[model samples]
Target: MLDQVKDAAREIADARRKIAAMGPNFDEEILGATRALYAPLIRKPSAAVKVTADVAYGSDPRQKLDVYQPAGAAEHVLVYIPGGGFVAGDKNLDGVFYVNLGNYFASHGILTIVANYRLAPAHAWPAGAQDVAGAVAWARANAKSFGGDPARIVLFGQSAGSTHAATYLFDPTFHPAGQAGVAAGILMSGPYLFQGELRPNLKAYFGDDPSRYAERSPLTHVGKSRTPLLLSVAEYDPAFLAAPTYELARAVTLRDGKSPSVAYFAGHNHVSTVMSFGTPQDDVGARVREFIASVG
Candidate 1:
């Protein structure tokens, strides 16, 4: 047991050294590397919500959702999109990612939908956007089966999932149309506006065509969006993730009848900002609940 503890400590120190060596620009990579260690350390809350798994929203195998229904009848629903920089992420982890996010909110009485979308490289930019919108449409059509209120549905997104959620809601071209009937949104640590310095794998996820960037970027479409938005950034997040959230909040407040909120998660980094959802460490989850309830 002592040796195991010592080895884990060494691994943590090694992860920190890598972060120091690579700098904040590699925040996503550093977060991914440390997540296997940190994610398991955080305990999973006992299941208080009933789960319905692998409900299909699209023909693709990845286009599926896990619905978390509260103990009592639900009055609101949240469609959660997990993050993996548009390329890698899953809706379920033993105690991390969307599983924790879905369980926490559903346990709080909001019927939560955690959905998987097609990944990048093999499936790029707009594919993520399309999948998210499809999930929202599915949730809207199927909310009542789980005793949820469709009119009060909110979209909660983290990391790349935030980008897809914003795109589905904000972009004029989207099919399910994020702005049509969705009540609110919570977008956290998304690299929506800037993709200028992305690594090769990420760039491939967004596509090789630089010319399509402005055409496909969510930052360009926020002016047309009217959804009540809560934008969050972590204090220790990389500059690329933190800066645009501030800019977006400023833009959101300018629009008439749009109530926008912004928060900085202190002492948390990109992944932990979202991973802390079901734990006592959660600070942003409270804000998200407040935002959705206020809108309802």
Candidate 2:
């Protein structure tokens, strides 16, 4: 037993060293390695938790979601959106990814919803936000059936997912009847403000028009949003994302006359930050839990 513990520690240390060496770059190799290292460490949801998989929230097949229902009553419902750089991603990537996140949050008594949105090029701009709104509507209507409070739904997204959640939370154009239904929004490493040379993946969704980028950006409309926000950035995130994360925080502070909750995950890269959930090395999971509880 002692040897098994020692082996796990050594393996974790080795993985961290390799990831640290990769620095802040957004590399597929690093993402795959990070997922591989933590997948085994993620615990399966206990028998107390019930999972309803592949439920449709919208008409499109990509608009399906997975629900993680806790043992007893849940104070809040968290809708988690995964990142795929706008063009790709899913609710369950490689099976383990977001399933682990759902299990982790559900175990802590939060009814977790892992959702998939429409991808880019085929469906652009407001499509992602529209899917998010659909998912939120589903949660608000059906949360009580799963032992979750409908009024306390939290919107959470990572990377491109974050951008979609931010758009739904901030932009009045996407809001239903000009009302942001979420209790709070948690945006992790999202590109809130689109500026300068737009990447091909981003352009695929936002289109080739640079002039419309500002108006379409969530940052441009955040000033009018009164909903609470929790912003986070990974320590080893690519340089391009770092600016937008802090810029969004600054913009929110300027608008609200106070700073929102901000978290910096040290020693974590873009992918590892979300992948670390349910692992022993997880540093931000507790913060996320606290944020949800505080908001609730």
Candidate 3:
């Protein structure tokens, strides 16, 4: 046991070094390296948490979700949207990623939903938000059947997924019957405002119409929405993504007359914010659990 403990400590130390060495870049190389670091460390899903995979939320093939059902009754349900740069991402990436995320929350007695939305260039713009609406709709209708409270559903999105969740929460155009339809929202490392030079991925999703960028941005609509929000940015997030977290928080504070709950994860990059879910170095997971508890 002593030897095992030492080995685990050494592994964690190595991971910290690797993550720190990688800096705050948001490229495939960094993302892939981060995944490689965490994959081996993440334990398999607990048997106590039952997973129902590839459940359809909408007609589109991409509009599917996976549910992680806790062993006991759950008071709140979490709808998780993953980030894939608006071009490519899924409910399960390389198998371990979101599965670990779903398991982590469900194990804590929160029924978890990991969802996939249609990608950009093929689907584009409101499609991701629309898919988020569909998934939330599905959760609201079916949550009771899965021992979860429909009225206590929360939206959690990371990166591009966070952008979609913010759009769904803030933009009335995507809301069902002019209703936000969610109790609370959690956004991590999202680009709320689309200012300055557009990235290739953003252009693919929002198109070449620079003039419409403000109208399409969630930050533009944030001042009007009254939904409770928890925003977070990693210490090592890329500038484009990190800047908007503060921007959205400021918008929320101005709207609500108080600062919204916000978190800054030290020593983590954009990808590691989610990748660290089921590992020992999971500060983000603890914060998320606390947020859900407070909201639920």
Which is superior by lDDT, 1 or 2? Answer: 2
Rank order (by TM-score, best first): 3, 2, 1
Candidate 1 lDDT over 199-219, as tens digits, reads 776687776677777778888
Cα-based lDDT for every prediction: 0.78, 0.89, 0.90
lDDT (Cα, tens digit) per residue for candidate 3, span 152-249: 99999999999999999998888777568999999999998886679899999998888989988999998668888889999889897899998888
TM-score of each prediction: 0.85, 0.95, 0.96
Q: For candidate 1, what is the lDDT?
A: 0.78
Please give, for residues 75-138, the per-residue lDDT of candidate 2 as tens digits: 9999999999999998898788898899999999999999999999899998999999999999
Where is the poorest 10-residue window by lDDT in model 2? 7-16
Q: Which run of 10 residues does model 1 get worst, by summed lDDT?
A: 15-24
Deviation of model 1 at 87, angstroms: 1.3
Question: How far off is residue 107 in model 3, in Å?
Answer: 0.9
Q: Alpha carbon lDDT of residue 209, candidate 2?
A: 90
